[model samples]
Target: MADFIPVNEPLLDGNEKKYLNECIDTGWISSEGPFVKKFEAEFAQTVGRKHAITVCNGSVALDAAVVALNIQAGDEVILPTFTIISCGAAIVRAGGIPIVVDCDPVTWNMDVNQIEAKITPKTKAIMVVHIYGLPVDMKPVLEIAKKHGLKIIEDAAEMHGQTYRGQPCGGFGDISTFSFYPNKHVTTGEGGMIVTDDDSLAEKCRSLRNLCFQPQRRFIHEELGWNFRFTNLQAAVGLAQLERLPEFVQRKRKMGAIYTELLSDIPQLELPLVKTDYADNIYWVYGMVLKDEVPFDAAEAMERLRKKSIGTRPFFWGMHEQPVFHKMGLLKDVSCPVSERLSRRGFYIPSGLALTEEQMQQVAMAVKELFN
Candidate 1:
């Protein structure tokens, strides 16, 4: 058997080490260090936002955004059922109801057509999560938000460097959040950011992440907040990673192209949609859905691939199907058929920045062999 191929391995050969050494030499390793501010500034400019706030991780970033937006008890936020639980959890934590919409089968993103129907008088915001590599159709979403007078919270965590009709993904909403998990395009090991053009919202987020410390009295706090600060070490690494984002995006595209070329002939697989009208696929992960005729679900397929020394990861389970949500009496009777099907059949293969051409070929061969 060949060497095991993990689902994701980050490429950190650039200035990561140099930046870490600088942090150690300067003895500025906390969130107050200069690098944290630098990372936030550069990231805001890169994403076309006026301000960016760093948090401990992407999940908390969503939490902070929800609170900063003033999502009160009984307020409702509409989001896709086919996304990480963090999306819905944020709203629920704020005592707001999470309204779920179905995803488009092709793009694997929230179906824009179904959004308006879910809106109610209680609806305060629409949370748009960009899935895998393709962005949600934002034009309709924007128009809908405008007509309804609702805020937009864009989850561009998987869409670093991606655009929608030439506009940057993070620039579209009232507030946007991103994750720097190792699998992301620009990673800081385990960090997240929230960017916005609103000055008041930016300050609220900064305060939220730091226990709401008053500037006049360091020990004084006007309200409750979390200690969700990003360390200087992580920011140093993120700054270096951001510098190489273009290169990483290019490499991911190339990897997607290769996989599509190799796997297009498979009759049992449903490959990711290559391009939508607004943007091309960035292949955050080379995901495939088994056709209805296939004998096994993703779990069996992943186990088989593991035996062949190839790594695989299952897709996000729909929020409606989650047991925790059911226990909480949320989304109990709601049904999203497309999200359910995708969750059972979809899984991503190794397609990370660290993947080499040889590994790509080997993965293709292994996948083909399994189907044969």
Candidate 2:
């Protein structure tokens, strides 16, 4: 038996140790440290945004974005049912209703065409979450937002170093967010950032992440906010990772290409769409959907792969199908067939930055043998 290949392993062989050592030597390990500011600034510049605010994690970044946009109760925020719970949770936590639409079957991203139909007078924002390896068609979403006067909250958490129509992924919306989870191209262990061109919105996010602290007075708060602060130690890791993003992206793309070549002959699988009119795939993860004729779902396939020491991860379950959403009396009676099918059928292979050619070949062989 081969070594158990985990679903994701981060590549951290850059300046991470050097920067972390500097932090320890200087005693600047908290959120007030200098590395946090440096990471925020560099990340904002890279994404072509005017302001970037660091938060403890990606979920709170969405939370801050929702509050910063002032999405109040009874206000509806349009989003895809195919995304992670964070997108809808942010709105629900802000007392706003989440109005979800289905994703495009091919792109596996929020269907831009369906977004307009879902819009209503109560709609306040459109949360566009770029799916596993591709972007939601932003041009149509942008037009829809402009037509309806709705805010656009771009979630580029899975799309670090990726672009849409030549523009950076995180630069497309009124406010954008990114995660620095270990699985991402840029890993900070655990961190997230919000970027925006609007100074007021930027300021709101900064205040929101730090318990809405007043500049003039300590321990004083004008509005209630969470302690979602990213520490300097995390920022040190993030800054180092950010510097190597271009290299990481290149490696990911190469890995994806190799996997596509290796698995393209398998008729029972639907491989990821490699390109679109707007942009080429950065291949954050090499995902596949089991065709209807496979006679088995992703769960079964993943189990079989696990027995062979090959790890896998299921695709995100749709928000409409979430039991918690039903418990909260949200998204009740909502049906998105595409998202439902994807949730059951899709799974991603190991395409992490640290994945090597030999491991990739082993994974491909295991998958092929299982199908045979």
Candidate 3:
């Protein structure tokens, strides 16, 4: 039997062990340690932000960002239909409605052309999620935001080292967020960050992550805040990962090139987009959308690959199609055909930093065998 190629595995052969061991030896394993501050500072500098607030996870980072911006009821946040439910949930939890929009069929990102059509008096923000590895056409998104006086929330979770028009991905938004899950370019086991240049927003996120208590007196609270604090242990791992980010990004791009080279000619598959005028695809995970002429959708295709000991993951099911939201009578009339089709047909192969050339060959061979 062939060894199973898992979809993701982190490359932790760097200073991870050294930093973790240091944390253990010093007994500074919690949130109150130097590594947390160091990680925050270093990451802020990397992303070209004045402040980067560490959080327990990416979901909380979005939640905190929405709250920090004071997005209230009657405000609408325009976001892609093809995104994790966390994006919509954050807006909803902040008492704002999420206005779903279709993605560009080719890029699989929120369509900038559709953005203006969705705008209304109630629209307050546009949430641009850099899907897979490609940055959204931010030049136009920024233009639209400016024209309508709308805030831009950039979810750079999947785009750690990616840039838009030479500027880092996280630098474009009023507030941006990142995840350090093992699958991400940067891994802390589990951690997240929110970055912004706005000083007041930065302090509010800091206070919100720790539970809105006045710093002078720990027990006293003026506002409700969740315990979304990041531990020093996680930060230590993140710092080690951050130190080697450029190398990781190069590895990701190389993996993308290998996959595209091997599988580009397969007739039944549509590979991840490669380049745009703004930026090149970083290929965070090598996703492919099965062409309609193919006999199987992503679920069926994934099962076939699994039988051959190849692991894969399906694309995000759009928020508008989510049962929870549908049951709540939200987005009842929303129909994003492109997003729905992508959700059903698209999935990613093994594109982890730890993935080897041989493993990618096996994966490409497996996919070709199935398609052929």
Candidate 4:
């Protein structure tokens, strides 16, 4: 058997250890350290936001964004069904409804054409998720939001170095969220950030992140909030990772190009699309959708690859198809056919920052062997 290749791995060869050591030496490990402030500032500047608030994790970042925006019970948020459950759950938890739609079969991002049709009088926001490595076509989303007076919450968690139309993805929306999980372009062990230009919203996020404690008296509180504060230790790692983002993005694109070059001839597979108008697909994980000629779904394909000592991951199941959501009577009749189909047909191969050209070629060969 060949060496077992992992699905994703973090690249921590830069100043990760040095910054961590600094945090330990300075005894500034928690949320209230210099690195936290520095990280937030740098991240805010990186994404072109005026404010950046660090949180415990990506889900909490979404939660904080929605809460800070005051999305309430009677409000509705339009989003892509083919994204992580956290996007929908964040809206649901904030007393807002999540109205999901299908994806563009090519980009695998939100189908902008369907968004306008889903908007209702109760619709208060549009949550645009930059799925995988590709940013959503935000032009139409922005137009619809402007026409309908709806807020835009961009989820750029999977699109750290990706840009859309000469602008960074996170800068496009009213409030944007990012994740720094180990699999991301930049990892902080486990952390996230909420970025926005609105001064009031930034202050609201700060209060919400720290349990809504009064500034003068820490214990005194008016409304409820979570202890979603991110640690300085994590911020130190994030700062180091942020510095190397350009290098990371370049590597991912190169890896993507290599995968496309190696596997483009495979008739059974549909590789991630390359679109240069907005931004090139960074190929976050080099996802592939099987063509109809393929006999099996992504699950079976992944299983076969696993047997070949190659790891893979399936695409997100639409929120409408979620058993928990279905049981709760949510999206009962919603049928995002594209999303549903992609869920079954799509899976990603190894495209991590740490992946070498040899490893990529190995993955490509394994995939080709399976297809043949």
In order, candidate lDDTs are 0.95, 0.93, 0.93, 0.91
* Each prediction's number of clashing residue pairs: 0, 0, 0, 0
The per-prediction CA RMSD against the true structure, in angstroms, equals: 0.7, 0.7, 0.8, 0.9
**Runs in model 4 with CA error above 4 Å?**
none
Q: Candidate 1: minimum summed lDDT over ten consecutive residues — where?
A: 363-372
Candidate 2 residue runs with Cα over 4 Å from true position: none
Candidate 1, 292-315: lDDT as tens digits: 998889999999989999999999
- How far out, in Å, is residue 235 in model 1? 0.5
Off by over 4 Å in 3: none
Across 1-372, the per-residue lDDT of candidate 3 in tens digits comes to: 899999999999999899999999999999998999999999999999999999999988999999988899879999999999989999998889999999999999998899999999999999999999999999989999999999999999999999998999999989999999889999898889999999999999999998897968989888999999999999999999999999999999989999999998898888987899889999999999989988778999999999999999999999999999988778988899999999999999988899999999999999999966
Tell me how far the alpha carbon of residue 353 in candidate 2 is from the true structure, in angstroms, after superposition. 0.6
Candidate 4 lDDT, 1-372, residue by residue in tens: 889999998899999899999999999988999999999999999988899999999989999999888899979999999999999999998888889989999888889999998888999999999999888988878989999898999999999988999898799878999999999999998999999999999999999999999979989888999999999899999999999999999999989999999999998888888764878888878999999878889999999999999989999999999887778778888888999889999999987799889999899999999866
Worst 10 residues of 2 by lDDT: 213-222
Poorest lDDT segment (10 consecutive residues) of candidate 3: 326-335
Q: For every model shown, what is its TM-score relative to the native structure?
A: 0.99, 0.99, 0.99, 0.99
